[model samples]
Target: MTSASLLPSGLRAWAQRQVGPITAVRDVSRLRPGSRVWELSLDGGRPGVFLKAASGVVAYQRESFAYRHAVPALGPQAAPQLVESSARHLALLLTAIPGRPLAALDVPRAARYEAYRQAGVLLGWLHAAGDLRGEHRVEAGEALQCAARGVEKRLTAAGDRVRAAERRLVLRLAGDLLRLGPLPLGFLHGDAWERNLIWSGRTGWVDFSRARFGACVQDFVPMYCTAWAEDPGLRAAVLRGYGRELSSEEEYALMCLSALDAVGCLAWGVPNGDHALVERGRAVLARLEAQAV
Candidate 1:
């Protein structure tokens, strides 16, 4: 849709060497919102590569670590396979996940049983595998801490903007950050927004920039806030997948993390002059506060 020459110079060279010379690069900027994921044809061949560029050095390095940890254990069917990665770019040369965004799935009746069922299965795998105990537990806690600090810093730096009339939601979410509960560390997709989930016959997730070891609830935030908020009945299916309720401790941890996430997004979205952050922040806060058990 919108393309702005996101190609990384050094990483391009690495791709050429590993996958062969790039005969054609198709800018799939048509993908809406978030990062620009491109499809590259090496030596003008079929099965063009999928490439995602990092925001900067720190992000590039963190995602590279995730690629190293997740691919082997989950197998080719799970996350995208890391074909090649460098300081600027991360190349995924995996089989394309076939499907539409689960967020886009439409079931007018307000209940999409099949979709919920599949989501359960996929999330169960991630939660079970996400534990911080194994050798795979690389920088997971740091990632969560980063999320925390990132939000804190933004709220401080953008102090002027937090009180803006339009950012009430963001501010509201930020206030709720104080009451977040306890949690155990584990591997988690730091950002689990709905669109990241691809739903064909099954649900597959991509984008590991936020993948890190942290609270187990960190893995469930987006699923709860963005996707399941409307019809919480779906929680049962996901719980069935996890084989338990969305525990109170996990709920509190997730609420805090999500508040951090929302406020951080609001802080970054300042340039857009958005006014919805406070509302979002409040919703997260309310969820945790109401569910205190």
Candidate 2:
């Protein structure tokens, strides 16, 4: 197809210039609803690369910077290689890592559990890779406050019981987070949910636009509330891959993060009109409340 018809003018021109003569955009797909992803074929029949173009300028800059600076620390094959990028044009070209997404709903039970273990192992490697500089660092207290705000914003639409339960949980969780003191911070795969991971020969993380520096445990909280909660075996396997179990303080912090994350999930669903996600978030919050007790 013609480049102009296939992509935004600036992005199309940038891609054609980068990929050289006879470049063609073969297929366009969305990894997420608004996340633009494209498959390109270059030099007639040669194997090609994947492209990501952000619709917003800020998002473009963030993802471009993250891929350039953060993906390297995760190791050679940990994510798609950043080939060419431009913040102004809001586009990126990356080596296409062959694999299917490790989304929870698509894989078999056994495979999904194994992918979680692999994900944990990859996360451990990333965390141990030393501190990455120039990232947007989010301190522990700040992270908790942000989560609490999201929960608070959603309280008005909740029943009395949910509001009361969430308020109590948020207060206690904030206190627990404070008592834990300063936590060891590192680069976080800010969105570490199942859908963001790809399992080829090895686990590869993608969508670094949300990457930030924060407490290490923050990365695993979502997994704990979902995959780990459903399967104890998956939890144990992930911990095993990570090299150690959480200490009491770490576990407390994790609980708090999980609860706040569930609240955010609920808030996100309410706006999008996704009933399944809304119900799942509510169920998760209730489970977290019981655990806190």
Candidate 3:
């Protein structure tokens, strides 16, 4: 595909020419079938790598930043290598860890939970790094706001009444919620749903469109509630991975944040792309609202 077709016209050519000789176009259509990434089978057969275009969305940017920062401090802890990247377009190229998405597997519940435990270690280390704070938070917020604005525009264009209206409302709500109590700030995966985790011979995180310096709860919510029933024990383990014990109120707030996120996505009608997330958010919201009384 041409550059305008995916990223800047010169992007692929430029990236291919960098650090090594150009080898392949790999694929072109990110969402259609193969546009998301390209396989770089280098000349020496050292090992093939994947190149992520910067034209990706916010969560994508967050993934790039988080991985880039974390690789040095904790790549082995819970991150991947950055062979090459273009934070300019939120594109990244890395050692693509081999793994089928965990969600795609028919694994035993015990094994699935184990994967969750290991992922928690990665999340924990990230939370502890504390490098992504203050100014970092502001930048991440900007990216999120940018993405939200686009979602707003797209929903409006999609002409889905409930969706467009809901998106507007959720944007407003997220703004209001942001004002709630100091709002736990830490690095978050932003969109840590099931399919995002690759479960090859090992478990690996694949996407980061939602990576941001915001509520750790945002990451926790998607990590737990989105794909499975509320696993309190697992949640505890995640907190433990962070090297901190979460307060009851903190846990409750995590649920609240997740609820808000679901509603926000529902407003767009594209995220999660199904009703289950919205329904789960509503249920969690009901419980939390009652608990607050």
Candidate 4:
């Protein structure tokens, strides 16, 4: 759909106000189903900007909040610049950051490892800011419970024996993580995979649709379960750049988080007929189960 068709009137007007007269507003591409991202051409002949019209009010608010509040604290160059935000229209206009996704790069294994290590350092800087610690946070217990329920729901779809064994392991891990007492809370990018890294001449993070406050380790789950699990050397580089090794309890909790992420991938993939996702989900689950044993 064209930007005009996808963007509501309120959002269109908001975009115009931010970028002066819009000579052209075209749908560049639908990056995702609900996110209507557009490239704009201004009559003033300046460089065009990008506008993201979120499909839901909650997503809009979160992205707006993340761009306006959370990401800015990271540094001026760490993320795309937010040109404007509109709560009523559920949209935001931003200066386009130049980069292909990190996942698309065809670098050597060592370069990939270094990129992940740098990503770890950037995340460390973000966590150090502590701006996301205030209201609108998901407490550690609540976040764990949510992940546990997601795991349980997905496990229920399997055979009786498989379900029973996985459930037992998941429950035990969940209990142990919860018993660790209140986890250190911090801002989570929520989805911190390499795909989200915009790797131009410099690295820039994007897509804060899932950004929120939660257990600091929760931020590591997606990368750990998928990318790092695939390459042990890459995982070590990330840990080295992170400047600390996980304690025993943290390692256990991380395993639990990985299991939760695996189940989520399973739940989404099974119904959608995504064979690769399904295979990955099963592989990660098997790894988690073996670790538990």
Candidate 5:
């Protein structure tokens, strides 16, 4: 539990204005230490709100835009509704959605598969949310080129933290993406994975800090690194719920993107001392190696 006195005065006042006086604030941030996320209890028994204080302006804008534009396509039940925002405080007050994070839930395989299937459905809706005409659309060739450049930059930054073999593998994948021709582009969750998905009765997505427009298959990389890699059936289940199977080109694109994701995990995890992330990166790389062989 957190006291109202503990919150920044400006943010507190802003929240009060939007949702009326808050009665209590409970810190609910998990995963990222020092992140300021609280569940708010309001006076008069109004529905509780979740307040997320962004780390910076960019993250704040991205998430605010997502809740405003992309998430609504999933309908009211599938994601948090933006109740209000305070740009000065970089804070967003959102309607609470029920469910525990899928990563935190212990459930039978059938139940887990159902949750993932629903997640795929929600993701499909999000990707298809808006027309990609005008500035929203990135030309496919340009998008691929940008992705390749991003891969190169991350690899370079990782430097010695990336092993010799891992470096070679990442470069090879980036090269492969260049030859794959144009890929379908649309809105992406940017950080789609089990942890960001919540499940009680059905899957609900949260956190759009990394939301953007890009290759549709890129959204699957996080799951590919975890659930899809461990169980082929889960992969099939999600795709089935997504309403179709990946094309050969998209399948190849997912492999390439997975490689980039793996190296990225290692690069960030090693310095930050997140062993779980480091191991996940290694595991993905091992799988990619096996496939290459």
Candidate 6:
């Protein structure tokens, strides 16, 4: 248990106002030193709550919107209930859901496959809930073109962080995606990696800091680099549970997106001093290059 005094004054005061007395505070953030997550044990034996402070207003609003509008469609069993939020403080207090992240759990192959399958089902439900087209009014081709430009800009900014060959691969893929027809769009759980999927008796999703409206294939990029890369069977299981096969164009888009993400990892990781992330980027790029050969 962390001493309440150790918490930021503003966070502690705000949390106390929202939930009354706080008996204990546990730091549960995956990133340390500057983490903003805390597990709070309340008075009167109330259920514990998780406090997540956003890094910025945009992040707070995006996550709050997802919790309010999108996550509920997945049902109470699939995600944590949003208790309350503070726009001024840029924080959210949520009901604590049970389970450890699937990435941290060491289970048998069969059990792991089942978890991935369940994750696919949950993601499918999330995407089916609504389309952003009604609100944003952006056509698919226009949206994809805008996304491609963003990727190109990022790759250019990456400069020497990415090898010349890798940069060319990403650019070629981006061009390929642009040549394809417009793709289907949906609300995406932007960071749907193993770490965000919790597994107790079943798989549940958490973390929506990156959730937004976009091409649905964008959601698979993280998994493609992680679990899908490790096991082709797991990838098949996800597609099976998703209950739909991606179009050939969508498949090409996935490759492009995955390549973009790999370069992004290298670009962001070097400056952030995250060696593991840089290594993962290198590994994914190597694999993609091998496949291309």
Number of the top-ranking candidate, with lDDT as the measure: 5
Q: List ranges where model 2 is wrong by over 4 Å.
A: 1-6, 26-33, 55-58, 104-110, 130-162
Candidate 5 per-residue lDDT, tens place, 1-293, comes to: 34632677777788999889989977777656447888889999788999999979999988998888888888767899899887889999998888889898889999989998998898898888856777678542366667766987788767787778878888988988888876777788888988899899888999888887777888888998898878988998898889988889998888888888877887788888889998998898888888772
Taking the candidates one at a time, how many backbone clashes does each contain? Answer: 14, 0, 13, 0, 0, 0
lDDT of each: 0.60, 0.70, 0.58, 0.72, 0.83, 0.82
**What's the candidate order when arranged by decreasing lDDT?**
5, 6, 4, 2, 1, 3
lDDT of 5: 0.83
Q: Please provide, for model 1 over 1-293, each residue's C-alpha lDDT reduced to its tens digit, 9 standing for 90 to 100.
A: 23375566665677777777777766654333455566787653556677777656666666777777653455565566787775534444434556676767775433455556655665556655643655555454444455554664766755664445424444444455434544555666666666666666665677777666665666777766655676677766666665666667566556566656555555555655455544565565465456652
Evaluated at residue 14, the lDDT of candidate 3 is: 55
Per-residue error for 76 in candidate 4, Å, reads 3.4
TM-score of each: 0.74, 0.84, 0.70, 0.86, 0.94, 0.92
Task: By TM-score, rank the candidates, best first.
Answer: 5, 6, 4, 2, 1, 3
Instruction: Give residue 144's lDDT in candidate 2 (0 to 100).
Output: 50
Residue pairs with colliding backbones in model 5 are none
Q: Model 6 — which ten-residue stretch has the worst lDDT?
A: 134-143
Which is the better candidate, 3 or 4, if ranked by TM-score? 4
**TM-score of candidate 3 versus the correct structure, residues matched by position:** 0.70
Candidate 1 vs 4: which has more TM-score: 4
How well is each residue in 37-78 modelled by candidate 6, as lDDT tens digits? 888999999988999988788889889988998898887778
Per-residue lDDT, model 4, residue 93, is: 86
